[model samples]
Target chain A: MDDPRPTSGPVPPRRPSGRLEESKGPLVEPSAGASASGPHEQPGLGHLLANCEGQELQPGLHAALEVCRPNTADLDDPALAEVQAALAADAGLRRRLASLQQFDQALVAALRDVRAPAGLEDRLLKAVSALAHSEGVEPLVEVEAALLAPSSDAASASCVPPASAEADHAACRDEAGYTSVRSGCLAPDTVLPSKRRAMRLSSRPMVLAASLVLVVGAGLVIWQYRRPASLPTPQQLANEATGQFQQDLSEGDGMPASKKWPAQVPASFPQLRLPQGTKWRTCRLVNVSAVMFDVTQAGVKGALYVVRAREVARGAQVPNTPSRVVFTQGVSRTMWRQGDYLCVLIVEGDEQALRRLLRPVPPVT
Target chain B: MVQDKPQDGIAELVARYHRELFAYAYRLTGRAADAEDLTQQTFLAACAAYHSLRDARCARGWLYAILRSQYLKQFSRARRLVINEDPTELEQIPEELPYEPDFDQELLQQALDRLPAEFKVVVLMFYFEGCSYKEIAEQLKLPPGTVMSRLARAKQRLRDALLHTGQPAFNGSMEAGVPQVVREGTPHVGG
Candidate 1:
């Protein structure tokens, strides 16, 4: 994929002109009475300056001290003691340490001042909400219902005020009310008010049970009667999957090379085998649960998507078949069935690289 | 329902760390738009993997790890990517700093912008994030000595830029050229 965004700003690169020490005129001049004798005798960093005697400060020793000064609290090296000694003996060294600390404070302040863009939190919430809605809205709805459902065990209810559990259930009821009010603080777009109302109405045990049965029955009926006609075409499935892959690539950013494939992926699914190490995460494409693997090989990147063969459109072809490749939007894509799993490979290169990426396709079990 | 919802935890996490994380991302990416994108991606990844977070206290570090990971993946192969492996090939540091060492933050950032990603990550995690050398070493999977080495080298460059030169002074090539497409995120589907 090509990057339209600039990695950095318009700052022109500058060449460092002089040596670090030369830019600064000089170190602290030694005190008239100071001597390089010892800390107990001299009592200030001026004694160390007396040692420098106008020659360049020892870079090796100074470099070692630089590492210790900022991290004195965390470091346990014997060198830390030397840094401490230098600090204790020289008021100059102590002042330098203080300056570094102050600089650190300023750094944290400056960086922290780079606040998140306005509405970032709102955007994040909406993105997560959309993902949750597609992956499964029922779970969130059920959670809302469970929160509102009255409990006979009020005394044992987790939300009951610690002071006492009311036999009248008023405390538990009030707590639940507070909980609902708090949930209302979610972003405006997170959960619709009408949906919350529906969930609340279904909080009754009988109502919830009936709704569950009806939902299951309706789902089965759709699968039996409506799905065959509704299945998307091979092209449609590929386009949708590709769109999703691109969206994920754009939004998901990049995967860490060391990140392991999520263990949550069920064992029943086929494992992705690519010459390049891959990281897998669960995703929804074409309304079906699938695993998306972020693949990279020889510095080229691509995505390999695996989903159940039964889930893609009939035109996707059930059962094993030869991989078919096509090019779209300057990328190469291919789809084929291996056992019960359907695989789609997308990359920016020619058919050879795309095929190369999917090499040694594990003998279909 | 009886307990705090997972979303609640995520909301709290976002509220606490989003700004800090965005700043870190900005420093890493050297651009606001890319930083915003990286921050959003970090949170999305965080939400997806929220369950793996065993301790709430570790969320800050965990989120940072994710952001850095995303940054590396996105830019590791970019033309500007560079790593100075010789830790001992030291840049000269000022013998003494002004009592305050105060300088323009943008200049400091510009200096930071000049560093290779490897050195840049270390410097930010240490100074900006206030991560201990140990914490940085553990997070980046490098030896503590290496962390100190990178931090020391980076600090010298920054100190030179901020205190001595009064402007950014590091030398590096600009991006060779923009990719034809956002190479990292490209995907296509064809019949």
Candidate 2:
């Protein structure tokens, strides 16, 4: 059979191209753009060959070796074998290969030692400083610090610093929104947004159905927080089990009959002395068990419920449950001039009226 | 994006990536002056597009992208300006050197420098960076198969170049009187 293309039998080693770059081939570029006399004017060192074991080595001769030799992973293993054999055929190829190896070694060393050039670190720092100055990017330090520390409900005893522009800014911002200064004097502002967010939050009720599950979760978190979670000593375990005896008194089926809850309830609290016009009175307080206490607060004749804490946790998913208000002794709901506060209206009748009258005050410091 | 603030702070990224970007731009434009212009243009582009960058860690890639666009824009303008002019771009070569490199290396460099702008970067990236065919493809946005074929062909051109020259000493060898190839009938030993 005859073929149009030429035959091959240890043909002279040929370097297909001298380019080390991935750009389109440079052969035509030399002829049309650079070489005045043209490509064929001088013969090329196309290939080097050596025969051994009926297999001939054919090492190519060109700068193309820069890209193909040394570091190039041998993808075409057989072809590379031929290349290596052919390379050995020429004493010059062997020498050049050695030189190329050195070059490669140097390159590897350089790459390994890559550094932000001389003064690069300083320059980078300077850039950061300049960007900070120009952009006024707030350092996240304060936010991060606040996140790490437990929120303190106790009032600060330290003297307040003189108000600066930041303080003035806060004051201006306080008045800028729908925030009201008087009790029941202002309409509710747009506090929340779009229907989508509300819908997403509605999925939690399914998870909260089992009182046992909630109680166990609360107990585990308390155990972990109040004490290190290292393996408890036998004595410690016995002590804990003994301490929980009073709580076990309210046991009811799979669900503990106790009324323990997790994650503090969000209650509208005194932003500023819960407007003086508001009245406050003790509703009631009673221990349902060692672990659970129930309390209700009654607002003074005119006041609204306003309780304040230093921090609040964002709400998350929980199970749905029926809401029932119980009239009890010692818990007092305070009255406020504005905004929603927690209201748990319990069982009605004479017990409810008496519960409002018996509401207890928050313990004084 | 450019909220009013002190101007001196941001001058750091300028100092850090600026000079290196200039060198990269030089390689890109094949001329020093245009490289400098590209460098300055990159900083401006960085300033203009700073807000769009979400990850500060990506600043290098982002800067490179900006430089690339700047190169393309400038290159187009250059093509338009040079349309009727046969301006020799040889001045892009450095004027002097402390020690003369070998003539072969010089010839190779000359041949490489003379290549069209498109081919030069491919060669630089391949040889200097030792990028893989796939990596080259990704950087140049070309197919990998094309990269392999192009590299093979590039080697062939070099082979032809060295073989055609025919000067034993000049044809990729410097030791005089030393034959590069083993002749068929050579003395096997020191008998």
Candidate 3:
């Protein structure tokens, strides 16, 4: 077969200074006084002449040189078919590729020694086990049992009317193995089936009336004394949002695409750049009208919540710059309003770390 | 087969990818303890959120994304702010260096550590993880062009570091002068 490769070109003379100059063409001359023993050096100019045979094979050579070995698919690319063909036909190009491959192999080999510490796998397994235990799906029986359990508070007990004797008997018999409460009206040892049933039926209405008044009185007292369900604080809201976002990600819903704030919104939100090593995980529309961005750094998790000023509670004060709000142990919330969005960042760390995580937002011009 | 059971699936994932994830974590954090923690957290988070993983094929990238995210969340506060080198200065690096096949692993690590985070990540994902430019770009949420440029620049810096290994100018910790650079710039946060 006729050799499709370009014919070998003349070699440039070796520099006398013993320093190699950058070669403009594929025909490179060995530096003067270069060690003959080195693997990269060729024996003579004949080898150099053998390598570069075409009009400016330098581009192809350079392109082939830039290709990483793992990107092997690129070698087959039609756009690089000429380069690939040349590489196959030319011994010198083949040698250079081989040398680069060797370099990559050596680099990989060097890095291969940095393995995970012993027992890391075990520790990780334990963590997974712990997580499983915490988040495992509850069995139906356990869920049902929890639902059936009577209120422990004495006040609540007064509010709950006693079950009918026959109903209690059926429940006790059916759930004998698991039932914690039998209706208080029936004793387990009572054997007078019909006669006791008649007496229980006769006393049921009076007992029910007395129970109703006690329930009503207890309800009134409890209602008067009970504290109103307080609204979730901003910190709590942030925590909930983070949890939901993670849940969404894990469930394969993926993150919602980030959209710019609506034009009608009056406030300018800070375009805070995340610190190095931190990445944008996902942005979600949350709380009906807010945007939540969940970000993670070095195993630490944080979330940024952006809500409109109108959406925020009336008289709610959000700082214009990052300010630390310690919500609970091991978590901190940072809140600031920029533009129309009340931005809050909830992170799992101390206040100092939270402050560091919340880089100062540049003013919107 | 284990994928049918969530716990078993997580265990399988941990068993398979822990070492690779840990190695990447070590490269990113440059500390064994932090790397271990990052790996552990990734798996735990995976376990907790595995229910949401709709595609089994995406498990590897998802794990990696989690690990990277966790690393960022944990260490963002501690990261030393670095002024990126001017593109012109980076372009001045020699295109090629004399091939030295016998370099120490520690020396290579030191060189890798000296690279900026963005560049280092691309290099690690490309060379060590065998990720293609597109894969790396997807993982890091960067444009493929940016990933390629970063990889190219990183390789040049590594070559330079390797060629100049014995000099004190490049030796010692690259982190020592970081505080000064950080002090010079106002920290801005957004992503």
Candidate 4:
């Protein structure tokens, strides 16, 4: 069987006319009378035609040539009109255009077959819904407050006695009894109407007092439960640091000098002592001056992030010693403050590995 | 009722264009998870800014513009770390692509991935998304002439790549003289 593949060869150098000349192979063949131009001679028609084969066309002519059959809109384009007129006059150019169009269609058709992963629509919907919820007009806290208002009002009303004396009390009791009956809370035939009325009038004040206590207690509980959790937990901070480190490593692009830490580091910067057999890969400043170092030990990767205390919010506290936090199975973070910088160390193995890494660092001088 | 709300319009937009946006994202990032994240982030940004959109017809392009912007922001760090390479030298590519009647999407994708980010994005916008040169130039904040030049370079590179990879072979015929018929109703190549 004959080997059908095009023979491998180096790309031919560009001719003085800035067009790539076809090399001697199955890649491309110059038509009749088409040959390479000499150094002193201007390119001939065959050379120009060969150049037009694929490389260079008039400014917008390449785009125009893509239209297999020009329509009214396509014809409306002055450049397309010129190119189409040229194509109408030349059969060779038309064939070349047809070939290019076929190739373009084939590529487009192939790409169209590569569908997006399944459930992407559902994932997008869920994401959009989450976005909307975060940006909604009524916040969760405010909505809960509005819902609690009416109940609170009813409780407060039942607590205060009517100001107009015994006659007003009787009217208030009558109104409450009427409301209860209308709401179907007080059913007929379950008790004598007079006895039910007497019981309601007696218990109304106590019910109001109890409701006030219950509402206040519930409000306190909700307030306690709904308070925002402390964000950027030690583990989360470590993950962020490691994530940035890993991303930089995988990108494989040499870091620019400007992104590197200052030659004369801040006096308060922490000093890190890596374990034996580990070497420091690189250090970079991230998120407006937080310095991070990429370290690898025995093929295990880790990151150390240090940010100045003054750069963070006021009242931010950093522990004096390495405090460990487990992010998940086999991953642990150790964090502490040395001088003015809050330092975090993240390791991929167990807590002992993290402890070992953190054990050697001396206190800030 | 949900569809009537301005916010809910975002859901409709996602439903309609998520696949296209994801494909574009996947092409740019070359990772499925990154593509998914980029797609999700684009829709989220669109939802947040949906109220500012005055024209519904512009939503498709708007979403794409947002995705491009988000991808840039997310990868700006990695991009900054990239050392500039000379553009004139063409890398050696494989000469024999898998011979299949149905074009190998993966081979084509690999070829596209080899293009510089600037050229790759313009090609994706122009060819895949049907963006006009002017529209792409405006979206990318580039001159129209520059867009044209980049697009031409990109197409030539792709053609060269396909040729080197042994594509454009119809019905197992690898010979040079095999004539391939152009499909009826060829698409209007946008300027």
Candidate 5:
């Protein structure tokens, strides 16, 4: 069967590739060479031969030869179909068309790859430097230098931000050009997005939900994991924190303690103004640290009392009867005398050393 | 603005992706200025909330994650883009680069600069990095189909613009630039 009527949709009379692309993928206009493809090329040679066979062009061949260029309009007519078919039949024509298409694709790719000009690069660099300098140039200096190098503005601009003066601040980072590093160290926030503007579905809501879920789920999670409550309220924790601080301040420096109180605050301590032969529950002497005391002398319990480095700073001392037990010892420590501030610490053990540990109960006034 | 001392892995991630991240930024906002600012802020934000990062190697995704959040924040502060119609495929891409002038690459760049925001980004990632559609989809959080159509529309638009006009002051191309892509009706094959 005859090759089923030129299936390739109206072979479209021979025209420039540029125009062909324009009407299809691109808008390639006719090249300056367009006018040169005048009429003679069309009616194609076949039509001319037919006309000659019909006895009309023997006279005109010379005229046609005399006329140099082909009429582009004639080449664009439907009558050129017969000639086109004839050309298609020729292997040479087929190869030529393929070669032309390849050439066209090469041209497009070349154009695509073209680099930005040096002037543009220079301007971009200068602008980048200026912007970077404005932001205090320590970090962007390298990028500024890269801008000054000989890259074409096309590549730079195609890749870089616009050259408008307003964009100077925005262009500082781009000035140095971009470098790829391992994920997770550099700030992606710093890179200018080329498109889509990084749209997000939700903002505070996600965070709110996450944190809320974290808190609510935490109870369930903790129930599942049975983790300890690692934290407590300020006041309840204050005493504990105070104890740690005292240890850090005093014993941390390797100085010995004045007197020793059992690790757990003592079960009892002698009270002030007790009857002649009466023994009393010793009050717990929890060290509040740093010129503060937690001596529970019967009536007193828990943490409260101020001690000081300087005698005068110690303020007034409470008076008790004749054989009072006062815990005091001046040791070689850099703490207390560091501009008149005192620190305290609680240590373990008792008596035999008590006397050496205790200072004279203020010489009964 | 990146968190050099990030609060968590995600924050570190923002800093890690800082430089390479701008290409995406520029692609998103269609303005280099906006992209840079957006990037810096994203890093800063990442650092501020380091606890949010779950994966370290997914840093690129993580940073991009922050950029998305930050961009939204910026949107409320100032009006950057106001897309009405579900922006045509062309609208999604950057314009096609045109012929170089005297071998100057800027002309082609100028053409690219004119493409729509989304389209331009897709093209950059595809041409410059040759990222797979899946990767693009993941980064942008767009459906893979959307990425494909966007890319197709972007390419066709670029081809159209390069062939038509390659000037800074020129206005509109029909189905050429990102804004006015001509519907080839059928997908473009070899052409």
Candidate 6:
């Protein structure tokens, strides 16, 4: 059978072998009297050919000799004349050359005779496509477009979010080296027939409804997983009081020397008062009116916020005693309902310090 | 205007050259399964390095180079090929054949599989890929004389095996390297 590929297809240019260049040098003939073979002396053709009888020539000399043979011999080689003369002079050498030539021809024929398996191309394509996908390399644009084509029922396609898909498509199209076979937007016809068939047969409203239900179920599961938590009522009151205290320190007016509550202080908290020498300021926090007092006790700075008992949070038992304490953000807070008002003291020191400040409240005179 | 990417033609490239590449791979590794794997790897690798291929006309050579590189990377470490120290004395051919012999593909492949890796590669590039001695030298980064010497040694070894003039055509004595196929009388090829 004729070989499927007769010529070397699209072969790169062959670089000329160094053997040809080496063979271009003048052939030096041995003198008739030169009979002794030495490492320094160049052997005659007869001696060189005979040397192959039981041993191999050195690689360099071997290449030079082989290049004088018919298959690979450079016709322009100066040594070709001497090698041919020597071959003509020896029948044994001529026979060996003939055998070598036949053997080379036979090897070439055998090697080229074998054919690739019939399914190799298909397998290769599929393997390469799968490899590209696994490695995150995009397939040819047409195959990518086919895989991402939206179904005819826009509602069914909503799960894929066509706006994002279109944006990606536009970005891919604008990429410098990305190639597209078609000029404009992807046409529905470019989708595979099998895919188109599946779409046509399975685009029922019931399937779309089931898909939507699955999506909603997934959303519910995620929502249940991430629900926000509510803090305990007592802790909530402590957080709000401490927040107002930190805010007053950073943004509220400087404390006035009046240790006594201002007249504007809600009458609901008339019972609330601090140490006599402490300075005071009045501020409203949310729906609750409160007075912020800057108190120094035992040389330690602290803040006290007083709000009405009802302002603490509905149903939260008014912390009437000094036992309720909350620690947050490096400040310790103690809250207790003083008569009709809630008094919260925030200090960077221990809870004992807070107890000391409020223990001898020094009745408001 | 958007130009078609060269990568888009990879599928077409497979169709055009797969057979030839597979044949070359089969010559190097004497089994259909291994040849398929090597050829597949070549195309897969080509997809990644496709940009380095500046000329479409030389795609055949480029693909062949990738296949050779992949083969060496895979087998070079796993198998240690034993190159006979003496190249000229590697094989002795009979002065003449009893009759003109018919060459069998299997026999030739078995003979090829027996050659050292370096020689086998040179032979394949020279005869199978139609690369010149200098081309093989450049690809393998060896001297041109070394390429010719290895080619000659490989051809002689193949000649003796095919002629069956030497002691039992391939004794399957594969030093440390793996045999390309299950030889006759052996249950399986060994590593």
Q: Individual DockQ of the candidates?
A: 0.08, 0.04, 0.08, 0.09, 0.05, 0.14
Q: Which stretches of candidate 5 lie over 4 Å from their true place?
A: A1-365, B1-5, B8-15, B30-32, B72-113, B124-130, B138-142, B166-191
Candidate 3 residue A121 Cα shift, in angstroms, is 1.8
Compared with the real two-chain complex, what DockQ does model 1 have?
0.08
- Cα lDDT tens digits for candidate 3, A1-365: 11122212211111111122223223222333223544335332223223333435633244234444532455665545666776666655544444444446545544543444445566667656655664232222123212221221111112122133422222122212111211111111212222332234335556767889999999988865452223334444566665664565457555435454434433333445454333233343334366555454556666666666544444455667875475554566767777666677766676766666666655779
Model 4, range B59-121, lDDT digits (tens) per residue? 655566667666655543343222123232111111222212233334456666677666777
lDDT of 1 at B153: 77
For residue A274, model 4's alpha carbon misses the true position, in angstroms, by: 67
Least accurate 10 contiguous residues by lDDT in model 6 chain A: A180-189
What C-alpha lDDT, on a 0 to 100 scale, does residue A203 get in candidate 1? 54
Pick by lDDT: which candidate is best? 1
Candidate 2 or 3, higher DockQ?
Answer: 3
In Å, residue A245's CA in model 1 sits off its true spot by: 58
- When just chain B is superposed on the true chain B, each candidate scores a TM-score of 0.76, 0.54, 0.72, 0.71, 0.53, 0.77
**Which regions in candidate 1 have their CA more than 4 angstroms from the true location?**
A1-60, A69-72, A75-79, A85-95, A136-365, B1-4, B79-91, B164-191
TM-score of model 4 vs. true structure: 0.42
Candidate 2 lDDT over residue span B71-115, tens digit each: 644463343221112211112111211010122322233343344
TM-score of 5: 0.28
Off by over 4 Å in 6: A1-59, A63-98, A121-354, A357-365, B1-16, B44-57, B75-78, B90-99, B114-118, B145-149, B156-191
lDDT digits (tens) for residues A1-365 of candidate 5: 11122222211111111212211111112222222453222212111112112222222222111111121222222433443443334433322222222223423332333111112222222333333234333223223222321221112212222233322222232312133311211111222231222222113245556889999998899864442233222222233434543453455442222243333332223221212222222221233232223332333222221232322223333233213322323211111111232222222222223232233445546
Work out how many backbone clashes candidate 2 has. 73
**Model 6 chain B worst lDDT run, 10 consecutive residues:** B173-182
Deviation from truth (RMSD, Å), model 5: 22.1
CAPRI grade of model 4: incorrect
Q: Write the per-residue lDDT of candidate 2 for residues A209-309, one digit (tens) a residue.
A: 35568989999899766543333322232233222322322341121222433223332232222222222332111211111122222432211211211
User: Which digits, one per residue and each the tens of the lDDT, describe model 1 over residues A157-234?
Assistant: 112222322111221222111111110001111122223333342354556578999999999998876776676555
**Could you give the CAPRI-style class of model 1?**
incorrect
